[model samples]
Target: MSVTGAGAASSTPASGAGRRVVILRHAETVDNAARVWQGHKDTELSETGRQQVAAAAPHLAAYRPALLVSSDLQRAAATADAIASLTGLEVRLDARLREVHVGEWQGMHADEVRERYPETIAALDRGEDVPRGLTGETRAEVAHRVGECVREVERELLPGETAVIVAHGVSGRIGATELVGLDQDVSDVIFRGIDNCHWIELVESSKSFSARSRWRISGWNLGPWRL
Candidate 1:
């Protein structure tokens, strides 16, 4: 849950009596375009990614985010910067929001990884929570860290407020599973990976007894135009 930044949330929550958290995936990156394992690599966004950020920024800004946070990686941080530009809030950086670390697979193409670790890939395809890249953290490990970040974000939020977090695909999806008390086994299939620049919306119930008194998904894999 370690994050770095400064500033207070400035706006009121949307017409709701709960804490809303948006976990947004970073835009497309050079490695993503090449189908390479981006895992903890400091890859920059592609040109299409820039355009994506431009389109997606407005939707999130419309939420009138009280707190803005992002992964320290450039891809996510850069995406967060766009939203900050629209809202005039400093982006808090957190490493926990980063994508799964690929270990030996970092920067390697998907085909190369398939050739090197067929069974591992197969297990992953079947949604097994094995350690990634044979050396990196397990899915549960990522869920724990990112879920901790979500909890920390929750503590920073006031009732009836919104927080926008710029993060990566794998982490964001799995983390949302943890945030909502879902079984870790459902990470890959239940909430499938979101496209670049898409986002997951979660609401924490507290203010009103009318709403379900637990965290729940409000929307998922949503793009700017849809929301």
Candidate 2:
């Protein structure tokens, strides 16, 4: 499915009462190139992934956030380091930001899984429970973890301070959906398939936060290409 674009802000005010959180998915990886389900199983960024993160550094530099947070996963940590180098911001590794654990499916080719476990794939498409391989996490579990992470971000926000979070595709999608209060159906539809390094911007306030805004920031596609 083609992802829709939300236009960028005309001007990011130098200061505002609300907090602006920029959510970035990490750069590409070898698994991403191969279209695998790399949930939680750590993987290093590919050469292109490194370059992509480097290219994104300057764009992120404009935000000037007080803190840069990333998933503890190596790929995300690496990307966060790259941004920290340019922005000179301290990077905090949040384990809550890690990718959705796909259990036994981790590091497996999507096509292979589909062929071997067609029924499971069908069940997932229908939002029904299926065997989540060894060490894998369920969709609901991921949503809860991401929600906690969002709370952490909200707690850490200070007036006029922006925080950048670099995370994985599944968790990023779940977090973005939760931020905007999007219904589960809509959230599932939007996040069912997404590119790596996709950027999502969310505003966190003592009152409300959301992902449904008209403002669109270019997201980095940083994951296994085949999700």
* TM-scores of all predicted structures: 0.89, 0.81
Give residue 81's error in model 2 in angstroms: 0.8
Superposition TM-score, candidate 2 onto the true structure: 0.81
What value of lDDT does candidate 2 attain over all alpha carbons?
Answer: 0.71
Q: Candidate 1 — which residues are off by over 4 angstroms?
A: 1-16, 206-213, 225-227
The lowest-lDDT stretch of 10 consecutive residues in candidate 1 is 1-10
Q: What is candidate 2's lDDT per residue for 1-227, written digit by digit as tens?
A: 22434313333445656667777788888888888888777888988888777666666666776778899999899888987997788899989999887877887898888887787788878976454653577777877888788767866877667777888887887777766556656667655544555566665444434434422323423221332
Q: What CA root-mean-square deviation does each model show from the true structure?
A: 6.0, 4.7
State the local distance difference test value for candidate 1: 0.83
lDDT of 1 by residue, 1-227 (tens): 21211112335665557788888899999889999998899999999899989988888887788899999999999999999999999999999998998888998999999999999999988878788899988887888899899889988988788899999988988777777788877545565677888888887766445432378877777775431
lDDT per prediction?
0.83, 0.71
